[model samples]
Target: MGSVGVAELRRSLDGLLTYLEPHWDFVNCHMVNYLTDDHWQHFVPEPLRLELNTAKDLNQAIDTLFWRSNRQSQQFPAFASFLAAGDHLRLENYEKLLTTVEQLEQQLATSTHTQLSIKEFMSAKKCHEVELTAALIDKLVQSKSTPNSTSFIVDAGDGKGYLSSRLALQYGHRVLGIDANTTNTENALSRNRKLQRAWNGLTERAELQSQGIIPARRGKKSNQQDASIIPPSLENYKTTSRFITTELNLSDLLTEHFDQQSNNICLTGLHTCGNLASTCLQVFHAQDNCRILCNVGCCYHLLREHFSQQEFFGNKALMDQQVDCGFPLSCYLQERKVRLGRNARMLAAQSIERTLAAKELPNITLYYRALLELLVCRHAPHLKNELQVGKVKKFDSFPEYVKKCADKLNVPWLATVEEEELLLLLEKHEIDRQYLELFYLLRMSFAPVLESVILLDRLLYLKELGYEHSYLIDLFDAVISPRHYAIVAIKQ
Candidate 1:
């Protein structure tokens, strides 16, 4: 389970695709289309549906199966045979196919790595991500066979410069933060300036806390002096607003910014969105100067798939303009024509652990939306699936939800419908609410399985490229940061 090699990764991908192929329709189906499409009847097996209906407490049973079973090895008495009944329902089989966080951490041996104190300026989650990712980048830098003392870091999609600022101000690495938006670049520079001013006091306070000592409050003048104590050499971080792509040359960009020729460049990103993550990998391989890569990607929903026929939620026109799609980075997937629809990729981003920890479920709006689809089909059959009834404000009842949605969609005829009719509609379909909730949970159980496919595809891409030093490190708490896995590689 430790750092999986090329052969093992290929086998895992093949097995995952095999298992997912039969259930693609389930994974790809939208919740909005649930009632109209007869999803419950089509997707849920009769035995499973009967078990759910006959359970003493369906909610408790679902909670036990989804959360307690995975966390504490506890299963609902009624649903004990759920997993054994079918391969699709078995969590153990999915677990067997995935490379776990523990295994990835063991492979990297990152638990013992010392981290810098920088919690004062970021959230607990961001603090965790930055500290771990920055530490890994430093380790990769030091591990280089031809380690250059002047090796610089290139932080792609560097929003507000959190990681780049830490790498420069604390770790003393020359860093260039690149982002797409101009406002982001300006804000990152401003944030870095403020961080520089506060670095000394922050570090001193962190050290005192570590040693179990509480320092007395200081005056404004004393704090100002502490802020001024930052060394001149530590101000090596720079940022630019430029859209990143595979064809972009890192070496040329470096020379343009720092006015120095550098061949040893470490390309890193913290939760780079959509195509940018794959773009970073492609840039790393395309540019000789990009000797190292450490990237943690998020927003799988925005990824453009070459083989997918469905339109994604993001800018489809812009996505079509791009040369390389985000998914299936490896030739193995490309050759097989692998495709993960937008809905399935979006599901991959969900965090089951966090949901379990909070004892959360899908909002009632999902049920309301599904119910509204029924009305849409009955009245406006042509607009079915075409209506963009986005998020409506909180409503106390089903009629209120319909009114709000109708107003938003500018369908006056829908709003003019009698309140009694809406109430009757709600009464008729009241039983479907619990069924929809069960469907939501059942689909969410596949989140990690889908995520594993995307991550393994990226890892296998590196393997296919003959990168012997590449590794996938699970670098953060999954509940705190769901997209916690980082793809790291070093050019030999």
Candidate 2:
């Protein structure tokens, strides 16, 4: 699959879009609309309906759609088949990429990259993301076509400099971590300083232990803990706080940190958010010095679709440019003027495997929200705006929930609605709750398919530009880092 180039990705992207176009409403629609909207059933074929009805358990039916092959004709054939198309989007055939630290101390490759687990520094998932990304960035740097090209990393949306810090401190790369938020930049710098001191102290302690001077503590093995952090020589790990707009220049930004003569940059962003991922690609594409790109994107809901039915989020003037605002980057979809709405993008961000493995049921919050909508309709019809009951926890009863919502919305009339009435409303809509959960699972099954559309669009964009070395490497473990696909492109 490493040899599989633009032609294959273009073909894959086209096919995925073809299936998704007509079924867009099915894959993208909200779970809250389950009972209200009669249209979801229209998307499910007759065969699927028959199978869903005959299932031993509704959740088991979901497992059949999500975990196993959807091609089975035994039951839920149509729905299962629909899900199978999504499974194809998993990048099962792509090349697995690994990087080796080539410096003298790292001469002998003793092992596959050791997992970094630093407490107080980050979550286990975050630790996995940073380590894996640094190694891949190492590969991208060494793999550069120009052997003499001095590699510097421009970390786009480098929130708290986790990846930037690792690359700069451990890998000895000159990293310029950029972020939209000023506070993040300041915090990252502060955090980097503390981490450096910790590493400095650990290095001394480990050296003493190795010299057979400092005795090892019993029941407290620190060698395993020490391996993750290297002796920190924080080499100019800098941050520039700014929003990554489409017009941002890499060459100009690099000149600010390095000498004006500096060139040969590798643009990398860990979990580049919303339109920023697309922004990173555009920056990589536009800048001559940006010879390599490794981007793992997240926050799909924040992406502004070029062809979306919803309002585009961000500066309207930015949208006026030729860029697609991260949607339908492929020429095939561009020709058809394809658009994925915000809701659709949000739905795409969900993880079916993680959700099912962890047994994450639909939050009762949905049930509360739906019932509140009904209450709004019956009692406060004049209230034009929707009431947002944010994160109500440990309520004794449904009436208490209503009172709190009423108080928040400043709707005194809700007090008049009795607890008996609220219970009756729950009684009336009890079946809707079950239906919502079932449909939520159905919607979740399309998660990977929708994400594939977004990722493949980016991959095809590189191919469209005539770069052949580009590949989508499933970089991190999905259970650890949900946004695991890294778009690696090298210009020949």
Candidate 3:
């Protein structure tokens, strides 16, 4: 494996792939109740509870579980053995192997940090992604492939143009925001107008605030530009959702936009969902114009799995596509035909750091969902698999919930379920709910392991294609942005 660039991902890929295989079935399979499905028992260990006989006891134990969960990071006390001794320790316990962020940035070609002159008006997560992305864009624009002044930025799946607006307005790069929906494009354009209008005096506000002075008095009018004052970003940006109805050719789009030179465009996507993220990689390889790529993807369950064990829902063409559906894109997994099911992909999107930091536990809603599934099995056996009892908190009692569900599903039989039968079912599973809650937490431990495999595979693909400048940067604070890892690449 080449150690200097993209090949560095290989150092941890083998171990991660190994850990991802055995747990694939556990993570991907649909959650079946531990009471009903005996097979699931093996996956969930028996917990030593504080006697969940009463409502208070059950609630307390559940709270304790959350307390423990929120305190967890990629590693925990119970996982010490597995994390240290497991075959994939390099990735499963990434805190040890990935080294420091400073080291990683050196290899990724992160440019020197210059204090941003403009004010940042976004959520912490959005701000982190933008700052990190801007840093990478700096390196790419100054790359030897083309003149830095002529290079442009293309934001794929730009939702409300948070990153695009900042890149264009703050960074002064000509940016085009592309979305699959016209509504998003319109909303982004409108928001950009508002941001531009508010752009005046933002720097002064930052400077004054740093020195502990109030920037302005809220209700007092000051010398400011009109709301319609268009900024350089608004003038440079054009957004449309027409791509939803048409095939996208980045090379053609960039060529048309700039007559300066081909291969001088930087393609970026923030939280691009499903195949769109994978498609970003494909675009990098297919178009020479797309010389730099910074992609962070989410909603793994939405990706179509080309491998045999892949999920069978959403976008029929994705399943039928000639290329792989975002899973195991690297030759390593491709050769083994490693398949991660839909559930596993969903699990991969989870954040252990966030959960631990907030003392967050599995929601009571999930417990209700599973318990409702049991009620369906008993009261309405025929409609058990057919009915989905979603969000029943509005009802005060079990019978009211059942009746409400019956109305939604149009099943008269559910309405006929006796109050006594409902009470009996809830009472019986009372303690089991706590057990299930603990089980859910335990299963979540495998989250980072699975995510590492998917990410490393993407990196390996770029390396195999002979682009050595590729690197995976640990971009954001995990608690702020769960999907914080970004795949960055630049052509030689």
Against the true structure, whose TM-score is highest?
1
Candidate 2 per-residue C-alpha lDDT over 340-412 given as tens digits, one digit per residue, 9 for 90 to 100: 7877788888887688667676888777766776677778766523454567776777788888777776878
TM-score of each: 0.89, 0.83, 0.83
Put down candidate 1 lDDT per residue, 141-231, tens digits, no spaces: 6655254445889999999999998888767788999998899999998887777767777777777877778865744656345443544
Comparing 1 and 2 by TM-score, which wins? Answer: 1
lDDT of 3 by residue, 9-96 (tens): 6667766666656666667655544455542355532232223345565455445444542233232333333433332342435553
User: What lDDT would candidate 1 get against the real structure?
Assistant: 0.78
Give the distance in Å from residue 318's predicted Cα in candidate 1 to where it truly belongs. Answer: 4.8
The best candidate in terms of lDDT? 1
Pick the winner on lDDT between candidates 1 and 3: 1
For residue 425, give model 3's deviation from the true position in Å. 0.9
Badly placed stretches (over 4 Å) of model 2 are 38-46, 52-79, 93-120, 145-148, 201-231, 312-324, 381-385
